[model samples]
Target chain A: MIQQKIPGKPVTVTINGKKYRANEGEILLSVAIREKIEIPHLCFEASLDPYGACRLCMVEVVRKGKREMATSCTLRAADGLEVLTDTPEIEKHRSILFELYLAEAPKSDVIRDMAAHYGVTRTRFLKRIEQGDPLGNKCVLCGLCVRACSEIMGAGAINFINRGPYTVVNTPYYAPSRDCFGCGACVRVCPTNAIEMEDVGADRVMKSWSDTRVPLSQCECCGRYYAPRELSASVLARLDTPLKEEIARLCPECRGKQLAQNEILAGRGGRATHG
Target chain B: MDERTLDAIIARHDAPAGRLLGILGEIQNQEGYVPRETLELLSEKLGVRLSQLYGLATFYSYFTLRPVGDHVITVCMGTACHVKGAVAILEALEGLLGIKSDVTDDGKLSVTTIDRKFTVEIARCFGACSMAPVLRIDGNLYGYATPEDLPVILGEYGWTP
Candidate 1:
């Protein structure tokens, strides 16, 4: 009998002729990352579901003398699953993809560094640099930022507009969005740091999304503008018991101190009512 | 274009699966183009996000967001058509219409005349390669089209000069 640590049934999968343990139905890319395998992947955030948009983590899954190329990010782990991450065929495919990405995001330092690591110094594909590009020409159109904004933050502020050869992601109608929360989930999840955002005097401006501005809430105690007003209001609304008005207006650091002081006073006094 | 008509259309294809595309197609057929208001109404009725609807509309070339001209001149840009001098025919139309073929920021190639009487657009293929260098004007397909034939063709549409 084996001790089970993870929730699912333990399964062993082979990657590049080496056996590794994985939970059943776990994403092969997640398993590879946990084992310190150098399988490069983008558009895969742990919090969000794997969509396999980037096609970087191509692996050859061998089954009964048949080999099929599959994205490891979307491939589920199973018992006796064998995959080759660095075969000649996979290397060739990855090199072409790297070249395409190089052409796609010509100004991306991350893409340049990663492509260089794979010995792809130049691309044969025509380079496209949009004049006055809002994303600084670093975006690979991986849809990570778009997904993070919509799926995670529920903002739905931006999306991919147009079709093949002319495809680009931006706010609808290339206008400043009214639906954005200014939570910065998109910025945090972007693989290439393509989204440009700034805190410019009492407002958080999403510079890439047509300079959409979200108002910042000022802390009553310390006079520091911390988070977006709408985001903070929505978060505060989700709390089980409503916080005191005074404490709610304070920033996180000031609120923490106030809460601690209240806790001490509550312990010392018999009937100190703390909201 | 009204709420009642939109609601009726939605009701027709409001099945459990694959309703959005069907509803959108019907709207495109009836309205010639999918209006923003219709999309907003659909979003509210179907509980779909506006961004997703916009994405679907833009992804398919069949759906046009802007209102199309009274007469649409669609030139086939397929390999077969290109080999048959489609570029020359297209350039001739541009000169005749006084509208340069401009690619939008999102990469769609379309140009409408100032009068909005004619719109010149490029299609990947109309799937009629046998009749290479095909151009369709308002559902009338002109096969084996040459730059010389454009003036005579526009005459049929009541265009002068």
Candidate 2:
């Protein structure tokens, strides 16, 4: 087994004139938050991987006589670097970043809460049209769910397919599969709650995660929700036997009908069984 | 209240919650960030609480509550950009700016490393996959960016190393 290298000894870095020691590879934002620095962030959730999508943790770092903006969640602490957490300029850009998020997902309560904290009562851009008002629902497309699934769950079940404004996340060919364990992690991490799952039958359901809805179906014999409709069809089509018809006919109601017909053909099944 | 200032503040105060963000954007453009005093004036004029005003300002990413520099540099750290050494580019920028991603320099240059920006956030694939690593200064796209290219890019924006 390849041994993972342990981070170097902790080093002291000054943030907003307050000095703190941080271990190597531990993000500055996490360290600051641990120390109650209150660095604003949206996409850096401890439960999930740090995406740095919200751009709210932007901070000023002075190192080796050079200064630049760095994401606190992604930036590792370096010795002798001076950091400023709440400068006037940082507040201004953070306000703007929040405004952009509002433009992308205006109705989100999470965004509203963050904005309230920062004192932004207005924005300069056009208001985002509400869903069904030509603009549709507010999904900023942070891809948090997509990353969480692949990185943490080890299920490459969902991915972004298509391009530009029309892009959406889905399984390949817009079909559900056994690869999806129905964990619902995608639904949890979605910033906008755009993806929805609805129960269609016993252990069977439909997922409206994107534009195209995928219907998940259960196996009639085993009563197990095996795969989505599109996936089942594609798989059975490749099989030589009449598995597709067998699947359709294996339901309790269909099986009962078949049994009655078979008995009637033998002249031994009649009104008693029918009733 | 001066006629022009009152009108500007009143118009912002009277705007709808959704439209309020846009109005605030205009105010920032005019005054170089949402002034705290202007926020107070708006709160009183619009009959909104200061807390409500702060809520709105902090809710969106585009509205600035404080002053910003003359030029803004936004680096993309989207998935495509990340796989293409966007982190290294951001580190190089940090070295050049003497400040971190969301902080502006004393010289008035605001640098931000955004995962996504504008209406077209880095939420989805940027479709500039061919460009690999990309950065935007004032909404202009730069592809195949490198640490070596930082000076030239900053120089074009009147930023001297």
Candidate 3:
């Protein structure tokens, strides 16, 4: 009897005419990308589950003489699965899809980069007229920011509203959401850089996030600003016990230096006691 | 919707209609649309990601996160329907609602009105191309619907003018 998917085992997959070893059940998009195989994709985040929204990471899979198109992000890597990344058929569809995205946000640098990569000179589809700057990054509605907010940060502040051409990410009831923590996780994970968050010395302002502004934690060591105070406190408060939860108000670099100094002091103390 | 009711609906999944789709279908039936609270409850109960739940919710036209009016009116915007004056029908409905082609204040077409009386939405197709320019009010299909008939049709649902 043939064994199917031994748990906790690695598998070999053939990608772009090359053999590569991958963890069983790993997303094919990540495996392809990790192996240096370029498959132009959007709507994929390392912190979120495989969402088959963008459909740009399409790859032709040949299994036992049957060929089919599958979104690499949603499909898992399996043993003996032959994946062709850059076939003309796949490239053709990617160009058409990118054109649609270009038509939406023509001036977006990320979209332009993809267009340049695919050699898309112009879009065939008509762009929708919306009130905003053409050169500013626009939401392609890939939902990465939404996922990062919900899945990664547990902040379900924003979600998809409307459908079809009018679909967009907005706070609940189209108002400023109470769930946003000012952590900037959504801004950091946004693929198109459509979201912008700024740390203004002592306060953080996220314009796209319903004008969210929160206080920043200053590093005790050097007076440099670090994480958002509310976000840090919220995360620290989520610990199992409520016994005096405290977060060190220090920058990462300062924290690292302090940790090393303490280790050296502890080592010298132990040597003195032992000697 | 209460959390206990949602838990009960989730427990009622069977071979035919007990899966996520079936459970969501049941929720949609009870609430006229999928509520965010219900969605969050289901996500919490099932340990599923919110994005995945939202992806499924947005993928289907029947499932809506926003509240819907007592009566939902959908106009077919398919190619066949579009060519046969569906745009005019949608425009008329928008005029009546003071919104653009079923679009809500948030630019979303599926949102309910302030009073929750009527919700206007655009459908991809009803699969009845023969009856081009079709519209549906509360699941009842109307064929060859014209812009002039908007008031009379809405009047049937106790909507005056």
Best by lDDT: 1
Candidate 3 wrongly placed segments (more than 4 Å): A1-7, A133-137, A238-247, A256-275, B1-161
Find the candidate with the highest DockQ and give its number: 1
DockQ of each: 0.69, 0.01, 0.17
Q: Give per-residue CA lDDT, model 2, range A1-275, as digits (tens).
A: 11115866788889988889877666788789889998887667666656677788999887776777888987877776688988888888988887887776676666777787898756676666543421134566677766776676654456654434344455543444434545566777776665666555544342543333355566565565545565556656877565456665365455566667867866853433322
Model 1 segments beyond 4 Å from truth?
Answer: A1-6, A16-18, A62-68, A242-247, A260-275, B2-5
Query: Which is the better candidate, 2 or 3, if ranked by lDDT?
Result: 3
Model 3 lDDT per residue over A1-275, tens place: 11234553778999877899987878888888787789988888766777888899999999888889999998887889898988899989999999998888765788888888889878889875476532153678888888778777877777876567657676644445556778888878877888877888797877776666778888888899888887877766767442212234677898777667767877877322111
* TM-score for the A-chain in each candidate structure: 0.90, 0.65, 0.84
Q: What ranking of all candidate models by lDDT puts the best one first?
A: 1, 3, 2
Name the better of 1 and 3 by TM-score. Answer: 1
| Candidate 1 C-alpha lDDT tens digits along A112-212 | 99999999999999997888999988899999888888888888988888877777788876778778999998888888888899999899999998899
Kindly give the number of clashing pairs for every candidate. Answer: 0, 46, 2
True contacts kept of each: 0.74, 0.00, 0.11
Candidate 3, DockQ to 2 decimals?
Answer: 0.17
